[model samples]
Target: MAAAVTASMQPKSMTRAKKWDEVVENAYRFQLAGYRDEEEYRSVKKVDSAEKWDNGFVKKLQRKDGCFYYYNKARECSDKDVPKTKLYNY
Candidate 1:
């Protein structure tokens, strides 16, 4: 099941993203929702996957409080935010 896969994907070490890219963008999205990444998000939210756009960017996310957050079609993660985004290694 999805839960088993997510559990196996847990990170062993983490580091801040040095540049802006798809991976950093995803990390930014997850961190904004108070999660480490997609795996953590799925585990906490109990969802199969985060809703994404046609361009493959995160489209919507629900926080722990049950509030939903929507993202724009454009890139949400900027150069200034790159240093704040964490990249996880399994």
Candidate 2:
């Protein structure tokens, strides 16, 4: 019981990062096509509570219109419309 509790309490250090990377990578690959079920993974990104930093957070792609880039400013996803390109060029 104690071991189980201890294990559960351990930080999920890489889990989130791994998931984030996967989402980004898939989005980068599929872009707007990911949304229409033309691609495998669903088009998804962090749209809310995005933060701005020294380097600035990159905006996500995969718009609802099948065209245009994500509208993001000051680390916040301001685009009322969905984006259709990768946050960064890979």
Candidate 3:
């Protein structure tokens, strides 16, 4: 049985990443930023993860394992001050 299962395993023709992989990667970055941004703009707009996360990695960020990015990519983003908005305050 083990031999039969091993024999059935064949490599796929598309095992390597395609040139378009970069496009999906770019989309993933955009989606993550948009998701964080919409937190303040929920009344004005919505950023849909399904419509934006073209890459699998970005989508995985929602999963428990994917959260490892917090340690690996800690410098990518932060909660510092949340940036300035249009409305100024005294």
Each model's number of backbone clashes?
0, 5, 0
Q: What is the C-alpha lDDT profile of model 2 across 1-90, one tens digit per residue?
A: 123223333334322112234344333334333441212222133244222223444344444444544434342322332243233221
Please give the RMSD to the true structure for each candidate, in Å: 3.6, 15.1, 18.1
Candidate 1's C-alpha lDDT? 0.84
Residue 76 lDDT in model 2?
34
TM values, all candidates:
0.86, 0.19, 0.19
Clashing pairs in 1: none
List the candidate 2 regions with Cα displacement exceeding 4 Å.
1-54, 77-90
Best by TM-score: 1
lDDT of 2: 0.33
Better of 2 and 3 by TM-score: 2
- The candidate scoring highest on lDDT is 1
Clashing pairs in 3: none
- lDDT of residue 60 for candidate 1: 96
**Per-residue C-alpha lDDT of model 3 across residues 1-90, encoded as one tens digit per residue:** 123223223222212213333333433333354322222222223234422232333432332122322112212223231222111111
